[model samples]
Target: SAVISQKPSRDICQRGTSLTIQCQVDSQVTMMFWYRQQPGQSLTLIATANQGSEATYESGFVIDKFPISRPNLTFSTLTVSNMSPEDSSIYLCSVHGQDQETQYFGPGTRLLVL
Candidate 1:
């Protein structure tokens, strides 16, 4: 299993601002995904960050609003741009485990836009 960690575990930001959340993994991983969990909703897939390619965003997510960077197998960053109250949520990063089907998630970055 790989150990995952996220920066800025919690933050309160002003509306219209942007925050960049960093995700780091102890071991190399081929599949890394970003997810968002709203207050009372289940986790929603944001995008998939592949090391050498542009991130593939999920249906409702656009690259312009949520830009992702996967510089290497063990590190990725997700930026919430022009954030608003509606964007306030718990952002998580996950990496596929050895079994591929399994995934390990980081603590998550909780953002509160006011």
Candidate 2:
């Protein structure tokens, strides 16, 4: 089983600000996924953080908007840069199941951009 934890459980930020969310996995994983949930929308993959390489972002996100860091197989960080009201969402950390390909999620960090 895999367990992931995230910091700054929730926060409210002003527009144009930035917040860095940290995630730590109890076990090493080849890929750690970052996701976003906006309002009532379903979770969207922001990027895939592979150890020792730059993160692979999803089509809608750019590096400037969401920069991810994967220092090792068990740790990663995601920065929500130059925030705006539209950036207000629940950011989550996830890891692929070791036994199966299914993804397991963290509780998520809730951000409110005003």
Candidate 3:
């Protein structure tokens, strides 16, 4: 099992500003995924950050807008660039467990762009 944690549990940012959220895990993990959960909506896969490789983003999410960094096996960061009001959402960090089937999520970083 991996213990995951995210920085700045919550934040309020101005439109056009960018915020970088950090995710740290207690143990090394192979696959780390980023997700966004909008108000009253289900989680949407944002991207997957694999250590030593570029992050693979899902449909509708561009690297330019959502840059991800996987500096090591136990750490990753997701930056929301040029944020707008519509970008207000709860961002989560998840890592695959030992079995690779189960995933553990971190306390999300909530962002509200005004």
Predicted candidate 1 versus true structure: per-residue lDDT over 1-114, tens digit per residue: 899999999999999899999999999998799999999999999999999999999999999999999999899999999999999999999999899998889999999999
Q: Write the per-residue lDDT of candidate 2 for residues 33-111, one digit (tens) a residue.
A: 9999999999999999999889998899999999999999899999999999999899999999977589999999999
TM-score of every candidate: 0.98, 0.97, 0.98
Query: Which 10 successive residues of model 3 have the least lDDT summed?
Result: 95-104
Candidate 3, residues 1-114, lDDT tens digits: the string is: 788999989999999999999999999998899999999999999999999999999999999999999998899999999999999999999999888999889999999999
| RMSD list, candidates in order | 0.5, 0.8, 0.5
How many pairs in model 1 have backbone atoms within 3 A of each other, for residues 3 or more apart or on separate chains, i.e. clashes? 0
Q: Total clashing residue pairs per candidate?
A: 0, 0, 0
lDDT of each: 0.96, 0.94, 0.96
Quote the positional error of residue 27 for candidate 1 in Å. Answer: 0.3
Candidate 3: lDDT over CA atoms? 0.96
- Please give the range of 10 consecutive residues that has the lowest summed lDDT in model 1: 96-105
Looking at candidate 2, what is the lDDT of residue 5? 94
Ranking of models by lDDT:
3, 1, 2
Model 2 residue 43 CA deviation (Å) reads: 0.6
Which of candidates 1 and 2 reaches a greater TM-score?
1
